[model samples]
Target: MSRMNPVLSFISHNRYWFVIIIGGLLVGVIDDNSFLTRAQYALQIKNLKEQISMYNSQYGRDEQKLNELRRNPKAITKIARENYMMKAEDEDIFVLSDDETNNNKENETTE
Candidate 1:
């Protein structure tokens, strides 16, 4: 077999080097343009503003709920009974599971 010349090998591989050169040119353009940077900054600012608006809306709703809870005595008692599970002074609380109750009724009929 004959030996290949270096110039001929390089000419054959020129397409790969051309791709690298073009990729470098594209990176240089993106890095040099202030418009791309400014656009990215504006998008970040808009996202932050949306997050702040959402937080403000949630905060206002929570504040209104807190104020209503403070002003009303019966509402506070109801909330405490439901959330904290506080019972009245003379009431029997029966905890029933829907599945277990149905099974008990079915077995009672069989017996």
Candidate 2:
């Protein structure tokens, strides 16, 4: 009687299991639309959602500021004076130099 090789006998016995494992690995890792790709896409979608929510909140704040500017002349004037450095006809504007502002920041940080 001839003795069969142990490796060949083991493989024949577990051929189905080997096929299942290889098929699973191919589906999960080697396919174009695999589990890893799906996971990466899900993470990208989550990040995009967070960015969208942040942008929506910023848009809401800008919309509220626009409404306030439209309804109240005082708010418009305040924004112009603070942002554009505009002055009234009889008002004096004391503009701080960039150096002065940087010095003030340094002093505040030191304090």
**Which model scores highest in lDDT?**
2
TM-score of each: 0.50, 0.74
Tens-place lDDT per residue, model 1, 10-35, is 76779778788777767655666556
Q: Which residue pairs overlap in candidate 1's backbone?
A: none
Can you give the lDDT of residue 53 in candidate 1? 100
Estimate, for each residue in 6-76, the C-alpha lDDT of model 2 and write its tens digit. Answer: 77888999999999999999999999889999999999999999999999999999999999988999998
lDDT of 2 at 60: 100
Cα lDDT, all candidates: 0.80, 0.91
Candidate 2: residue pairs that collide: none
